[model samples]
Every structure is written in C-alpha cells, then in structure tokens.
Target: MSNAIDRRDFLKLAGLGGVVFASGLPGFALAAGQDEFYFVQLSDCHWGFEGPPNPDAKGTLKKAITTVNALERQPDFIIFTGDLTHTTDDPAERRRRLSEFTQIASDLKVKTVRFMPGEHDSALDNSAAYREFFGATTYTFDHKGVHFIVVDNVSDAGASMGGEQLEWLAADLRQQKTDSPIVVFAHRPLFALYPQWDWATRDGARAIDLLLPYKNLTVFYGHIHQEHHHMTGHIAHHAAKSLIFPLPVAGSVPKRAPLAWDASEPYKGLGFRGVSVDTQSGQTALSEFTVVKKAQANATDKT
Candidate 1:
C-alpha cells in the first residue's frame, strides 16, 4: 500500500505466475477516504544516457526528484513510465546503470514508486536484467477504486506485448468488475503511431482489441518523448515528455531523432505529469510541469 493510506489492503494480481504484493492490487478492499487520490508520472529518465539534445543529462533525474518533492501537494506515489536507464548491450554495464538509477530515484520524497522498462532498459536478453532489478514487468494494481494495469511492451525482441502477456491481461480483466475505471501504463504506444521510428508496438492492436470491451479505459505511455493525445476508440491515450530529451513529432522528418535542442530555452520540451483521481466526481486531472525550469536548467548546463 502507499504511504498515503492508513492500512495496506493487499490484493492478488496475476502475471509472472501470479504473485501478491504488500501494495495495492485487485480484490484489495478500497481504503477509507479513497475517493480522491493523486500520483506523479515520470518517464524516459535515461539515467546513463548522454546526448547533445540534453547537455545537462547527468542531472536530469536528480532535478526531477527535487521538483516533484517541491510540489504543492505531495503525491500518494510516483510511477516511472519506463526507460529508467539508457540501453547498453554490455550486461555488467546494464546492471551498474540500473543500480545507480535505483539509488538516485530513492531520493524522492515519495516512496511508493512503480517501475516498468522501456526498450532501452528491457530489450536486451528478454528483460532478464530489468526483472532482476524491478519485479514483474506487467501486472495490475488498484488505487482508490481505480484498476491500473502496467503492461510490458518494450521487451520480447521489440516493442510488443507478445502472446503470453496478452493472455495474462485477458484473464486479469475477466476478473475485474466491468464498471471499474481502468488505466494502462506501457512503454510503447499500443496503437501504430509510427512504424518507421519503431514507435508502434507489433502486437499492440491485439491488446487494444482485448481492452475494447471495457467501458472505461485509458492508456498513459512514454516513448516518443513528447506530449501527445491519441485515442483508440473510446479509450484515451496520452504520452508524457522525457527527462532526457524530446524526439521530433512522429513522421515530421524522414527519420526519428531527438529534436534539435532549443539552446535559447534549454530543456524546453521536457517535463513530468501529475495525475489525480476523483472517484466520487468521476474525473481525473492531469498537469504537466517542467522539472528543470529555464533558469535552473541554464545553470545546470553551465556546470
């Protein structure tokens, strides 16, 4: 359970042979006063990745933590969408980078942090290393009557949910009450956003097909490194900006690349989002705020 709650209502969510967490999950009794809750969503930290798009890449994630901690209201938890670290084929380097990321993120004021892997973090060796650091790439959890499904689409040879995970998702949904609000978090866009950039998930259509039956569903993902709003039928999907760098809008150029850094306003296309749920009123509010503002980012770039 989150630190915001008085008592943890443990629930079982099936995936990776069906494990139980001390935190929220399906079948867990809703906590008292759970009608309203909020959490932060961060993505594409790329902790060990360095590139020209972000001259101050080293301090990217540290700045995010400081910014989140200073929010007007502390969130119940923080959910990192994916790409916790940059991709590296070297196994030892992968472990070292991920471990370092864990340490830096631990500095956050919020303790209930959920992690998934992006292709950069999980595409190597079928996500074996990612699982070693963060358990269960895909699973379901509940918070304030909301059913949240965290899916793994960046592993298994490419950005695809694959057959086994699809089956698990089906079984999980079958057990949930039909009217429950559903929110999905994945690293890749579930729909075919842009195949040329390797932005689309190969088998995402099948996943969306399964979710089409639900009355209330939404997906929050991180990969494109920009703010985007898309819809697959009634389900709303939104992508959050990356802490590292921003990629060009899909198909805007012949190939996908990080947008040329706006030197005049460094860190212009970078920020994090806060998502709040209001169960009694049946609504959610999302806000995007920059982690490293212009002045702060400018100073960071100098050092």
Candidate 2:
C-alpha cells in the first residue's frame, strides 16, 4: 500500500465536527456537532523528567485531569498514549515513577483508563513494570460499535512491531468484519516521520500493510507532541499533542528536540485531546485542549 495521503481525505476533515487535525488536506474548514460518546487522550506526560523548558511541569498531568473532569459531559474513558514516566535506567526508579504516574491518573473520574508504553516506559526492561501496572501491552476491546486495537511498538526501541505482535494483530483483525470502524492507538507514528529521530516505526510498514485491507481504520498516536493527520488508502492517522511539552516538526531542525516553552506563558502548547465517536452520525470529532500556566485553561481552546 502506498503511504501517501490522498487529496480526498482532506475534504472529509471539514465534516468531521471540530477536529483539529492537519493533513495533506488543503483549504479545509471547521465545524462542530454532538457526539454519541467521547473519551480523552493524554500523552507524553514525562512525569519525572525535570527541565527548564517547563517550570510548572510537576502539575502538568494533574492539571490535565482537572480540565477533563470539568467537562460538561465527562468522557467514557481515558487513554494515556505513552511516556508515563521519564527515561530512567534505575530499576527501582522505573517502578517508582510508574507508580506515581498511575496514582495521579487513577484520580480521574472515569475508571476505564487504558495505557500503552513509549520508549521511556518500555525500552529499559521490555515494559515488564508497565505490564504489571497495566495489562498486556497489545490487546483489543470494543466500545460502542468501534473495534479498538492497541499495539505495542516501543518494546523493541526501533519503533517496529515485531513479527509476533504483527501476527497477533492479523489474527485480531480477522475476527472483526472488514467494514467495522477500527481505531489503533500506539506511541509512535506507524509511518516514517523521521527515521533519525525514531519518529517513524522501523517495522511499521508491515503493520500498515496488514491494516490496508480495512476500509474504516484510523490511528491515534503520540511521541511527536503536536497535531497531525494523514491518510493511507482509506486508513487515516492522527497524532496527538503532548501533556508535557511540544516538539519541533519532523525534519524542521537538525535534531528532534522539544520546543522551548514560552517564557511569558508556561504550559502554553501543552494539553490533552478529546475524541468523540458518534455512531449515529457516522462521524468522529477530535479537539485539542490547551492548559495555560496550570490555571484558567479552557478545554474548548481549539488546537
């Protein structure tokens, strides 16, 4: 299957109901509507990472939870895309950070919180600690009429879903009807956004190949720390903004580094995403809500 997004997919985003997604879609307009159900996506929290880029980092995740809770209509569940903790080589420190991160996320009003690993959580010990806190890294579940597939792409550090996981994904998809709406969640973009920075998954091509046969497939991923969308055949991919800090666009600079925070306003570009799926309307609406200075952040801020 070709990786290039078609010109037609951009036209569909206009009718998607207030989704802040960038694609090969040129001259797209925005619109809003009611949804059948909604959920929140929180990514790249980097709980234990300390740095000058963000002064109010300590309250980042907590602030995200508070904002989601204040939503007029609470989401049905929450999914943390990855980077539950900072990169820690210490075994005990890994467990400590994961524990703290889980505790904070556990405070959310919605109980069904699903987690996948980023390089930080899965690289060192092959995600053993993450699995202990969260179940099998790659699995599937059903919500409403949509089939949700969560894949583990970070355990290898090469951003490739190994052969074994790929096979499992194949078998999982075999059970669902070809026309069922499918949503895939992972830490890294399945396509090669930047091979040097590991933004693109090394073995992601095989996975995308497997998914090409499906008519209704969409991917929600993180690690890029910004809003992006693409189309491969009929499959659409959307990358979420981060909870910690924003990163530079793919290949915009020599290095793939997190963008420096605005000195005047902290947490300006950091926020979470809310995605609502309305089976009735056959539409999905995504909104990126920014957290401003850990106070007075509105969830309605589009992108």
Candidate 3:
C-alpha cells in the first residue's frame, strides 16, 4: 500500500495532537513566514530613589532614554518591567512619585509603552494608586502573531502573584495555541531564583506549568536588579538589570539590596536591557548596556 498521506489524512492525524493546535496550525504557518518584531525592556527604574546607591537616578534614567532613542533601529514598543517609583505609604507621596515618573516618561520618543507594577511601586493597599495612573495590573497584547502576556506576579507587600492572578494565568494560557510564541513579562521572576531575600515568586511553579504546553515560550522579569537566566525545558526565563542600580548575585551576600557604587565611576553599575524577538526564527536576544551621563557620553564623543 502507498504510504504517502493526503491533506485529509494529515487533518485526521492532527486530531490526536489536541484541540489547542488543531485550529491554529494554519495561522501558525502563516505567522512563521512573517518578519520578526523588536522591543525594548527597561526595568527597576526607581524614579524616586534618592540615595548614595544611586545619587543620579533621574539623570541615569534620562541617559537610558537617550541610549534607547539613539538605537540604530527603533523598537516596535517599550516594556518597562517595573518599580517605577520608590516606596511610600502616603497616598500623596505615591501620587507625587508617579507624577514625576510620568514627567520623565513624557520625554520618551517611543509611542507604545507597557508598564508593570513591582513590589516597591505596588506596596501599601494593593497598587490601588498605581492602577489609577498606569491602568490594569495584568493584561495581554498581540503583536505580529505572537502573544505577549504581562502578569502581576508581585504582591502588594511581598513578591508573589496571589491566587487570583494564578487563576487568570491558567485561563489565559488555556486560550493560547500550543505552537504560538508566548512571551510573559512580570516584576518578580516566575521561577525560584533566591527565596531567602524574597527574590523569587511564591507560586511561580504553577505559572510555569500553565505555560508548559506552548513550544516557544519566554518569560522576562525584573526585581533582583541583575541579569540572570533560568530554563525549564523549552521555556526560558530571563531577569533584566535595573537602570537605577545593580544588585548582588543571589546568595553572594547576606542581603539583596542594591549595590553601592564607587564614586569615581557612578554610572558604571547602572544599565537596561534591549530585547529583540525574532518570531520567524523563534529566537530572542537580549543585550545590556549601562547609561553614561550626558557629560561623560559627550566626553567620549570628543575623544
């Protein structure tokens, strides 16, 4: 008997593969042939932080903006991973911090900007004030055939996703196809990086399981204030660096506070990440670069 299968036979075989991909193969195939899209990932800006760890936090953020604006190729959008402001229990202070943060954001040349809440900005009353200014705790957006899911993994008082967000995540992943390229973003890492300092998400394993069925899945996060990568099977998790300050490596120190800088080179330790997502190749690349103060940058330009 002939072994060659016809289109009808292929469809019949696909039935056993599951319903998630049965209705999505055509769309996936169409998407696989399209061009890739790129985006910028900036994290832990801490716009209101005013301490020795970063004496020029505001200036560094502006330098980062300049760096992004000077990129050889502009990204399709910008995703600020979180910690938009410093901690403040007072509502007035929180609002003031947010206003200052927005004032800085207004200078951003990129039009489409996505924001998430970190524990610092979400603290005291469950991010009520943050939602009023930034809108929505967790949400999803589709860009160039890929699904981008931004979750609220950090709790109001701690690093956690809580039960409600987990349920929403399960439902959301259930709605996506198996072959779709899924990119998840949040403040705290979904995997346990270092629980001693509250660096990892408490119920992150459940979230990881929810994404297990997808073939091309990547999770981007910021909270540890450094760069790290964790892999669980096909899903890859990346922790982005902070624009304000860098943190000690997990277990490297007794505490997880931001690293103090040398006065001689204050901007040496501050940086942001640029992420390039290639859907056609199913590959993503992240590059980290520190912000140089305009004067320092200008000094280099003259040399």
Candidate 4:
C-alpha cells in the first residue's frame, strides 16, 4: 500500500474525532505493502479516585473501554501509558484498584495490551504492587517496523529514571541503527514543560541526550492529564489525555489540580486517543475521543 493516508482513510481508521499531526518519517524506510498499524492509548485512569473533579470516576474508564470496543476497526494493540490507578496510602487499596482496573480493561476487544506506571501508581511503593499487576516498569519491544521503549521515571522517589535505568537505555539504543523508527512511552514529560507543578522529569534531560543521536524518535507520555505536543530537536513528544480528569495547562494556574468538572460538558476534557502509524511513510496520526457521546453529555446536562 502507498504511504499516503487520506483524511477519510484516517477518520475511518480512528472511528472518532481527530486532529491529525502528520510528522514525516525521516530516516526510516519500508517497502510497498509493509506494516501499517494503529493502537489505542489511554492514560491516567486514576481508578478509585472520587471527588468533585469527576463524580463518575468509577464509570469513566469502563465507558472508554466500551467506546474502544465500538470502534469501526479494532486496533492492533492497546497501551496504557501510566497512572492506571489513583494513589492510596494503603497497599491493599492500591492493589484493589489495580486489580479492578485490569479487570475492566480486559473487556477491550484488542489482542495485545501494554502498560507502564505513573507516579500515582508507583511512587508510594516503588512499583512493587504495579509490578505484581503489570510486568517490569522499563523495557523495550519491537512491533512491526517500529522500536518501542517503556521507561520508568515514576518508580524512583526522585521522579528520575535513575542511573541504572539510564545505562540500560543507552545500551539498548546502541543496538538500533540511526534510521530506526523509535517510540518512547513514559509517565511524565521527558522535557521540562514546567517544573513548578512537577510536570517535568527530574533527570529527563539526560535521557533526551541519550536519544538525541537518533534521527527518527517520538515520545508518548501522560501525567500532565492533557493533550500536549512538544519537540526536542527532531524528536516529538506527545502527551495523551487523561481518562479520569483533566488538569490545567502547565503553570496555567497557581496549582496543578484537576480542572473542575463541567456540568454542561460532562466528559469535556476527559477521553482517550487512537494512534495510527503508517510504517510505509513513517507518519503517525492521533484521534481524540470523549468518554461519553453527544447524547450522553446532553442528557447529563438536562439532568
């Protein structure tokens, strides 16, 4: 198939609202009729979270799963970037939330699902519970023609990847050719968006230095609880929308608290996204979908 993707084709692939960002596949090449796949990215579900920011916290994740299942085309896989559950002092409560989140996510029709940890999920216990539920916090895997690396920035108390994981990342990057298409998943922004609100990784700059040598690299992350796009040299960093509640933009307000729930817009800033990767051209598009449909939002407004 040709690398070119038309708008209609992209919408059909996403089956939801999308604002496309077509980044050229610089340095990576694939022959005609090569691998082209799309995946769903849902982040910061914060299961067990209950408050004014989201009264329907318990139901939002399930709604997202149902929406994904209703998609016109099922994704090749699904990945949850981080913050699978809200933070709790009680270990038992944390595990309970993780278990519940996993059970609900299993309803997805997709075959493969990947996960990582956010500070809320890993910081308290250093990911002991998260590991028991998910696998290693940091690892690398290849899908089709793309190289994917999951980094653990939340497991460390300092919110840094730590020296050991940094060494591991460097060793892994050494194995790849410069032309390889690399995608990174992390819980926090790899670049400093705003440190005042803790939106940035403590030692993310070191990790970026390690990644700067590559010609084709992109980072998908969460924890900011909003859709954000940034560039560090040629590498692109995109943050997914949260499944629980949305937060104010970096330094937008005095604090980093979640945006207040909108009565008129029940699921306004809360939703998940679908990422489409065209291996032939090395282009990726993101489609954003709300947790509830227009009718649902309207009904909530009427009530």
lDDT scores in order: 0.78, 0.76, 0.74, 0.81
Best by lDDT: 4
By lDDT: ranked, best first = 4, 1, 2, 3
Cα deviation at 141, candidate 3, in Å, is 0.1
Candidate order (TM-score): 4, 1, 2, 3
Candidate 4 lDDT over 14-131, as tens digits, reads: 3432225433321111222436667788999998999788888878888888778887667778999999999999999999999998999899888699999999999999999999
Q: Global CA lDDT of candidate 1, please?
A: 0.78
RMSD of each: 8.6, 7.1, 9.8, 5.6
* Reference-based TM-score of each model: 0.86, 0.86, 0.84, 0.88
lDDT of 1 by residue, 1-303 (tens): 332322122111212211122222211222445556667899999989886878788887888888888765677879999999999989999999999999998899888999999998988777888899998898888887788899998887767788999999999999876666778899899999998888889999999999888866778899999988787887778899999999988988888778877878878888888765554322445567786655787783442
lDDT of 3 at 178: 87
Top candidate on TM-score is: 4
lDDT of 3 by residue, 41-76 (tens): 889888778877776765778778877777655678
- Model 2 steric clash pairs: none
Q: Is candidate 1 or candidate 4 better by TM-score?
A: 4
Which scores greater on TM-score, model 2 or model 4?
A: 4
Model 4: CA > 4 A from native:
1-19, 22-34, 300-303
Q: Write model 2 residue lDDT over 1-303, tens digit each, in one string.
A: 332222244235526542435323221122223225667888999989887786667877787787777765567788999988988889899999999998898888988989899999988888898888887899898887788899988988666789899999999999977777778998999988778888888888899999988766778999888888877666778888888888888889998777887755667778777776644332455666765424454232322
- At residue 60, candidate 3 shows an lDDT of 74
Q: How much is the lDDT of residue 109 in candidate 3?
A: 85
